[model samples]
Target: MTVSVLVPSSLTREAEDKREATRKLGYVARAAAVFRVDRLVVFPDSGAEGRWGDGFVETVLRYAATPPYLRKEAWGKRDELEYAGVLPPLRVASRTGSGSDDSGSLRQGIVTEVGSDGRVRVNCGLQHPISLPEPDEGLTEGERVSIRVSSRRPVRAKFVDESPPGFVVEASDLSTELSRDDAGVRIATSRHGEQLSVDRLGDIVADTAPRGTTVAFGAPERGLPEILGVAPPGGDEGGAETERERTDLPADEPDGSRFDLWLNAVPNQGSEVVRTEEAMFAVLACLSLTE
Candidate 1:
């Protein structure tokens, strides 16, 4: 079997955008390897117009040229995708105000460092200093601590205090620490999942940036199961241990070949591709079960 790369011109307009598109294509290629996909398609989308800083197609080629995870396989054909999906516009909202409450709140800050001592310092962009929360009842320094902060008003922030209250709990308390540096300051984003550095957006560090922005892109073929190094859903004895790997997703088709072929024709719920990615994913998942 052979593997292929797909690049939609619409996704890549500038040098950076083009590069990103290539990376996405490479990701798909890698996913294809995992799923053993043959005859991949490269479709270009020209949804982007004069807004592109540099030539979109050229930019995509530059970015795509970078070796992706699945670069091991050589891409074959190149085509144009008539319509994939309508990607929403990018909106960056300003952070202002100070007064805050529960109804309307969000966490804002700049991550300074991931401490070797197990403490994270964040500059909440507030005038006051917020205290760090106890990692866990038994959390010690050098241990990873997760924190979640939300903006109350514009400038004011309310740290989600998950710390177990000591005998003497107060109405107002700090959950994380902050410090000033040459670059500017450091602040915590959230502690529950991955500890993100809000100080840096994209690849560089900046003092002021939008609280957060969502980007729409194709989902990686290798998902949680692969990252965790687990086998597909069939309860493979040689797979890693994860809840998702053990569960079977609802499939639109049952027969392995027909289902897989059918799915390839649809786009996902969000994307307008003929066959939804979700359906294909569903079929792939069932195939994994049998594997």
Candidate 2:
């Protein structure tokens, strides 16, 4: 399934310092990798941001998502990545079957310099930048592209038309991402949504696996209900249940709602508040069980 994960840019607002914030995003990146997310979108939540703000959040996340070999070339020195050292390594899984590591594999690279002739210099995590002919679509400096590496001893590689391993990172507006034609089953995760149970697993997997799914999450303490200004389930009562609660929302049928389901993926949450990274694992672990 084509999974898309959305996190508010104010995700690190509750962190005590840059190190803490950067570390938190590390786990978030790990969650994306573990779940094989296709796109990790950072939606704007500027009003609730801290001193780091969205810029810091975006920069660090982008840096973390970059493959280790291409990192130095892709992202040079940046004030926003001061605490990037705290980020945990994201060991994105390998592709099996036909394009397995045994055979030639595709790797993501950043164009260091575009040549005037018909070639461009790319840093694909080799000893040095290599030269290759530009694609029919052409290439630009700083543009990321996929390269097929056949042999490392002789350094045989070429640019190819395909996505490399690992999830992509980008920033976007919540509405726009949710509105995408391929957004699949949109889910908003909160502590006050429908509780998920084993009985419902079959239906959810059958429904979302084929169509793909897009899941949105909020910052620490700021649940999806608060982010979208929607009252949590039973908000009028003593309070909404701290479990997997849900609401009906269909992408094709946008009933003035931001998501197709307001899902409390983690039911009977023992912790008073689940960090965004923790929530990602708890929520996605269940969703990942799809064909």
Candidate 3:
């Protein structure tokens, strides 16, 4: 099953400095990798956006998602990646295999050149770029592709019709992300949402496992209801009145109703505040549990 995680661009809003912010994003990346998340999306959170914006969040997440070897090729020099060194290692499964010939390990490759002879030059984390015939039509240079190496001694490999091993990063608004056709079982996590009981979690996982899952998170200080301009449950009497002044949130639907489920995954919180990175680990750990 495919799992997508959505985090607000203002995730690091509470960070004391860029170094701390980068470190926080590192843990977030590590959590996503540990949970085998397929996609990590950065949604806009203008209200809570601090010094860093979407570009910084996307840059760090994209860099963290990229394999250590492919990082130089995928991204060169960027001003936004100042503290990338602090990002934790994902140690993705695909990167752990022995590079021996018969390992049949899948590796990510960048199409360096597409020749007229139906052959393409791919740099698949090898000592040198290898030229292999196109496995399918419409291959182009700079396009990322997956390949499996059968023999590394003689450099034998084939393009595979599969996604590469790591999760991809994307930046978009919450509405657009949730509206995607493949965004199955959209869940919004917040402290004020319905408390997730053991009985309810089983049903949630069972229903979400087959079709895929897309889980959204809020910022450091801002919750989903605040970001979406939806009044929280048992909010103040003027909550709706205040929310209506901010955005065009529909009056009929309850606050955060756009999501299939609004879960208070961390009920009885120990701390007064939960950091975004910390929440990612806690929530994904519970939701990813399999029977």
Identify the candidate with maximal TM-score.
Answer: 2
Question: Residue by residue across 1-291, what tens digits does model 3's lDDT show?
Answer: 778899988888888888988898899999999999999999887757688874788899889988787778878888778888988888888732455743577898889899999888998889999999887676888888888887789887888777778799988877787777888888878777667778978988888978888898988778888887766633422121222233455666553337776677777889998877788898898888899
Candidates ranked by TM-score: 2, 3, 1
Candidate 1: misplaced stretches above 4 Å? 1-101, 108-120, 123-158, 161-291
Question: What TM-score quantifies how close candidate 3 is to the native fold?
Answer: 0.86
Q: On residues 118-154, what C-alpha lDDT tens digit does candidate 2 reach at each position?
A: 8999988888888888888988899988888777888
Error of 3 at 10 (Å): 1.2
Please identify which of the two predictions, 1 or 3, would achieve the higher lDDT against the true structure: 3
lDDT on C-alpha atoms for all candidate structures: 0.28, 0.80, 0.80
Overall local distance difference test of candidate 3: 0.80
The per-prediction tally of clashing pairs is 43, 8, 0
Q: Give TM-scores for every candidate, taking all chains together and pairing residue i with residue i.
A: 0.22, 0.89, 0.86
Look at candidate 3 and give me any clashing residue pairs. Answer: none
> Which residue pairs come into collision in candidate 2?
193-245, 193-246, 194-244, 194-245, 194-246, 195-244, 244-264, 249-260
Model 3: residues >4 Å from true position, as ranges?
95-103, 115-118, 234-249, 252-257
